[model samples]
Target: MTISGEFLAFISLALVAVIGGVLLLNLTKVVHMVVGLVFTFIAIAGIYILLSAEFLAVVQILIYSGAITIIMLFGIMLTRHNDEESDSKGGGWKKVLLFLGVLAFGAAFYIGIYNLDFGTEPAALHEKNTEQLGVALYSDFVIPFELMSVLLLVALVGAIVLSRNDGEKEGDKE
Candidate 1:
């Protein structure tokens, strides 16, 4: 089968993203995992760009690759870790339970996906997605959008507060 350029690009990006995820899961070092995460984020952004969602692609890069990754790396570095090698791959009962859980999840996912009956009708493709997105965000979804923004702001503040080195914890008697 002759694949179009767009199809080839999508496959390449998908492979890169999958590889990054696999690497992130298997890597031992925290820093190595962060690098893999960056690859995954970039690949996802590339996919968004290919789909003509330029704003989403830029937002993905800015929020995920730039901010979240940095925050995660800092969290990892600041937290203490035992340097000893662990048998992370569990033994005996743990392994069996893990296998069973994975099997159950896979079966459920397959069944859920198989049961989906999307109709054959073509969807309306909006050409001016950015304009439509702006209008919807400002009009129809304005309350939800503002609420989400406030939620995110509160979460950020909470994270900062949690990460701060408050001297009270160091001192003794209450």
Candidate 2:
């Protein structure tokens, strides 16, 4: 079988996503890690678009790549942290072990699913997906969605209050 453009795109996006995740885990700086996370988020959004979920792709980009990453950056800037790097004598060995473990898991997963066939045709779920999503979300999941929003708001307020208290304590000692 010949390689299709869609398959190539998927492979590229998946590779980028995996690389971003690895960078996020291995990076030393908080800002760098956030950048890696943004890369991963954007790649995932691309995959969503490839799968014809335009609404979900846009939401992924906006919510994850834009809002969440910005919030994380702001948190990193507002928090006090030391710029010193700790000496890790055994870090190299840990990295090697982690790499081997990841490879083993990947091989196992690939072997398990390589020859498996679902024998199913693709459904036209992309048609009216946004409308369907909106209807389901607003009608069936309205209460849960509103509750989640309120919970997030409370968490944001609590974070601000706690940070302000910490700032006041620092002022007291000065």
Candidate 3:
């Protein structure tokens, strides 16, 4: 088939996202993983822009790439882990089993998706994407949104408590 600019852009963004995810999972260093995750998030934001959802693109950049990355970096700085240590304690059979399990799950998911048919009359696409999103967030999805806020608040408190414990331990040593 013929490749258009939009198709090329989409393929490039998808490759970047996939590569970034692989890097994030395989990276040993905390900072490197964060960088990989940032790459993935930025690619997702690009995809959102390509879809003509400018508001979603901005939100993805601001929330995922900006705020979430900063928060993770801060959390990394606050916590202590051995830089030179590696976690490779396992058996070969475990890896084999895990790989097989993943393959099984993928097969199941593929079969499930392949069998589905959403009847062929295409629904009208939403116009004014930002307005629709805002209305949905406030009206239908408000409870879930508020719950997410509460979860974030709890995570912040947990981080503080962890840092404080480390400080107290250091003080005892001194």
Residue 154 of model 3 has an lDDT of: 100
Q: How would the candidate models be sorted by lDDT, starting from the highest?
A: 2, 3, 1
* lDDT tens readout by residue for model 1, 1-174: 789999999999988998899789768888999999999999999999898888889999999999999999888998898656687555587768866997899799889998798889995554887887899899999999999999999999997778766664556336
Sort the predicted structures by TM-score, highest score first: 2, 1, 3
Q: Write the per-residue lDDT of candidate 2 for residues 25-94, one digit (tens) a residue.
A: 9888989999999999999999999999999999999999999999899889988987678998998899
Per-residue lDDT tens digits of candidate 3, residues 82-121?
Answer: 7785557675777788679978997998899997998899
* Per-residue lDDT value at 38 in model 3: 97
Q: Give the runs in model 1 whose Cα sits over 4 Å from its true position.
A: 88-126, 164-174
Q: Which scores higher on lDDT, 1 or 2?
A: 2
Score each candidate by Cα lDDT: 0.88, 0.93, 0.89
User: In model 3, what are the clashing residue pairs, if there are any?
Assistant: none
Better of 2 and 3 by TM-score: 2
Candidate of highest lDDT: 2
Model 3 residue 129 CA deviation in Å:
0.2
> After best superposition, candidate 2 residue 99: deviation in angstroms?
0.6
lDDT: worst 10-residue window of model 3: 162-171
Candidate 2: where are CA atoms >4 Å away? 115-122, 166-174
